[model samples]
Target: MTEGRDDRGVAQTGSNARKVFIKTYGCQMNVYDSQRMGDALGSDGYQPTETMEDADLILLNTCHIREKAAEKIYSELGRIRLLKAERANEGRELRVGVAGCVAQAEGHEIIARAPAVDLVIGPQTYHRLPQALAKVARGERVVDIDHAVEDKFDHLPASQAGQIRGRGVAAFLTVQEGCDKFCTFCVVPYTRGAEVSRPLAQILEEARRLVAAGVREITLLGQNVNAWESSDAQGRAIGLGGLVRQLAEIPNLLRLRYTTSHPRDMDDALIAAHRDLPALMPYLHLPVQSGSDRILKAMNRRHTAADYLRLLDRIRAARPDIALSGDFIVGFPGETDADFEDTLTLIREVGYASAFSFKYSPRPGTPGATMEGHVDEGVKDERLQHLQALLRDQQAAFARAQVGRRMPVLIEKHGRHPGQMIGRSPFLIPVVLPASAGAIGAVAEVRIESVRPNSLMAEGAEAMPEAMRLRA
Candidate 1:
């Protein structure tokens, strides 16, 4: 969201510490990876620099979710290549590196094509970054993409940025990695590897550390978050629901949530936890991807349109005000107009609070890429526009419905104007209100004043009475 390299306006130097500038692009998991990467370099005495010009090491944390995104990574490499040359002319050391899924996918190509890249470490081997950089310092380019069995989380040092930046009121902690469901159009299973959930103790420890560093809300992240399972305090096995319940016990941890969950993995206990744990915000981002049973089968989604609706029915029955969000891929291969109509029908039926609809872009080696009847680019574009129009209308209507309600918003950052701070409603819309710096990281009751197409404008916390504020 920050513009250009110097958007954060961080100082160039800090106690003679060599600065590392990280440019992260992609999902929440990629964001979390960038933070840990910075921490890795931080332990080796490198501080964070917002500007690319001042950085000794510049890493591009990439996502390989789609072909277009991959090309953009290469284009960014071109710009960084020029920057590397400029730095060399000034006799400044600028080590360009590639990390995350892109590194895992194309490490050698990057090394061969972009010779300026000195380090290429996959998400799994990013824990060895300091060692790889040491090799780079010795004038040898490094490429390490092995799927090491060890836990990278254990090797990571305490993030200096966590102590400094903290990533605002809410933070993402990845409790699960990779995917087991090999969807035809997905590359996460290859790039992120098989499904693996972190130990319960490890996740609890990280949550406590994050909370101590001033994070009020934590979203447990994963390619399939609901698939998470680990032991409880009594050595009994528990699902993600139990984890949320346990996390709710933490003092000052105001809210809890998880993302990118699968309908099949939505256990009864987890649904019940949604009803019981008010700390778990009344929102769910369950990605359905498509509505046509034929397309769903082709995508290897292993669920039908009716099945998803039934699952949602149960979930909503448990937590009545639990707002729903979903993901949709509009133009998958073999998606006919009737298929598209089915999608729109499901969309209307669900009444989504928000939805992300994208034209399907095939990735190499995926079954969908080679499948017959691939939707034409023009058709894909048209369908996406139509799907997005419907979704936007739904989003706007949902925001309008909240115009007279009082909701707890977590203050994330300062607004552009003086005495103005911005926060996110439980539904994840940005709300601007006149406030002081003290409001950051606090959940304040805001009376919705006006509804925008995307976000909402709200009155300050003072407008809401004490008895009406959300406590749980």
Candidate 2:
């Protein structure tokens, strides 16, 4: 085992602490991972820096989901090399590293291609970063790609910052890591390893701490959130609903939500949470990927269009006002016009509030990458446009419906305009209103005056209705 360590200099203390700049790319999961990495490094006496030029260490946290994500990382490395050279000319040593999925996917190839990088650690191995840095200090180019089982969360220090971006009303709390679904088009299972969940007690503790820190709304994060299962202290298995119910008991925690769930994992407990827990927000982001049964089967998604529709029906039955979001892939391998139509039909039936639609791009080491009958790029682009058009229409309709409705908006921060504060409604709609900076972190009743394509124009109230106010 190579003990990862930074040989550049001894750990700093007090005002002389070394600065580390972590540049993160890709999903919300990466954001959470970067925060944990920051927490771990902070424990090791490495304070964060905002600018690369002023940092002693630079970590590039990457994503490998898209086709050119690795290439983009290489491009960034080239730019960083110039800065490293400049520092070397000034008799200073700067440690550069790459972390996250790209590091896991490329491994030593990254070091070979980018010699300026002192360390390369994968997402699974971030817990070993301090040791990796020590190896770097010893003049060894370190690469830690071990997919071993370890609780990286245990190494993280408690979060010291409050109201990220000074928007104190909401925060994202990661309760789970990795995925097991193994969707053929996704690289998550390979990069993030197995479906490992944090213990319920740990999550609850973190949730309580977040709420105490002025976080009113918490979005529970996971690659497949609804698939969450952890044993209690007495070793009894509990699922997501139980977790939501437990977190709801936290005083001052006004709203709860989770995301990026699978259609197959839409279990009874999660649906019941929507019905029984008033704190749980009435919105669900379920990624169906594709609608055609054949394409879904090829993608190894295992759920048919009908299965997804049934799940949607159950969810709506639980919360009639629940707004829905989804993921769609256009022009997947072996997909026909009929398959594309099936996706459009599914979207129409679900009447999604919003959706993310993308053209299929093969990722290396994934099952879909080797599949035959790849669709033409032009065809994929055409289908993607068609899908987006329909989604835009539906989203506009949903936004329009919110007009004149009173929604509780948790004031996050000042908007682009002066005297305007922006926040999110329980449905996660961005609402901008004319209000004072003092309103930040407090929930205010906002009447939706008008709807833009992406945001809502709202007005703050002198007094709000009790029913519209969210209570913990």
Candidate 3:
């Protein structure tokens, strides 16, 4: 998994006495949470640092979705413990903390295993970071994992305009949290709690604030994002479709997107939004863990392989040019060779633009861990290889299809070489081209010259009325 960091480079530590280095893991939600945690700590005069050696405090905002996640955290803590001792020998001070799902699940175990850790705060209590740090300042070791009653957003301080500007033009705004669907193979329900959607007005206020700070693109984030629901001022019920429509009205907001939707929540109104809204990008990440109905039932996904295919049919019908992405898990408990073949069949039928495939690793407290017919590790490895090879081929085909097409690219940052810039296409593919620094933060039309494994090579767009007419 890629680590998330503040777009602004190493912050100057002269103004803020205390400096924090936060290492973020897991999903976009964790990335959003880390930024808010930084904002919360800012109230106590703490600035962000890129290097941990220059920090007074270090926090690990972790995820429990992957296999052996706790073990990895413990290993990192061991390294940090040695650093803490080294700082003490030099007559300096350092403090360590753990946050996010791993903290929510492991709690005191992290402190017991890594005595050097001074504080452990769960995702729910991150808004109380200032108080937690104050407690730690008094020579206290603190662990607060209780689910907070108040909305964390209500307590967290608004981010400063300077900080937002430092983060570049794209940002993530979380509109929903947690998951109500208790998929047996997952831990999100236990770690993030039940599903909760923020109030519509509260979301609008945050969107306006982000736009006012020079953010041009925003992607709404959640565990099951499409499941978001709230009410308007007229007391009319609204789902994600209505929310996207309202957000599109924000001035200067050029692009909009959301992620990690569920097939069960792909309502008609939400599909219509895809058809009607030009601001909403034509890309979707809908996960269907397995294609076999029996395996899906065992995983408690509720929707069958056929149901997922039909859902895609409707989604494609609404927006024919849409790019499709999905998630898959190989060697699920009780999955037979026939079941695996079924998955391959479904993949062939849908032809994904890109996909994330994984070998199932059962969490300790999850029901799948205790299920019968557990596939051998070797079998899992072999199956995962077969699945990934197919996915890579499909992804390459998708990239090849984009060659010679002209699309609007959002210039995000400078490239590795001089006189070049990098940006993201509407489908989230990175595009690199020769350009001046002045192009940063401006959307520019570019023609795809070639394709790379993970990105597209592009040049300044030419006068091609045909390409412009076909671009969506």
Q: Which residue ranges in model 2 land beyond 4 Å of their true spot?
A: 1-15, 161-167, 436-438, 460-472
The lDDT per prediction is: 0.84, 0.84, 0.87
**How much is 109 displaced in model 3, in angstroms?**
1.1
lDDT per residue as tens, model 3, 1-472: 2122222323434443677999999999999899888887765667789999988899999999999999999999999999999999999889999999999999988888899899999988898887887788787899988875777656666787767777678999888888999888999988888888888999899888898988889999999999999999999999999999999999889899999899999999999999999889998999999989999999999999999999999999999989999999999999999999999999989988889999999987889989999999999999999998998898899999999899988888887654567888898898886674247778888789888667887854222355442551
Worst 10-residue lDDT window for candidate 3 reads 1-10
lDDT of candidate 2 at residue 196, scale 0 to 100: 76
lDDT for position 220 in model 1:
93
Q: Where is model 1 more than 4 Å wrong at Cα? A: 1-15, 160-165, 436-438, 460-472
Worst 10 residues of 1 by lDDT: 1-10
lDDT of 1 by residue, 350-378 (tens): 99998887889889878889999989999
Superposed Cα RMSD, model 2: 5.5
**What local lDDT score does residue 415 receive in model 1, on the 0 to 100 scale?**
71
**Which one wins on lDDT?**
3
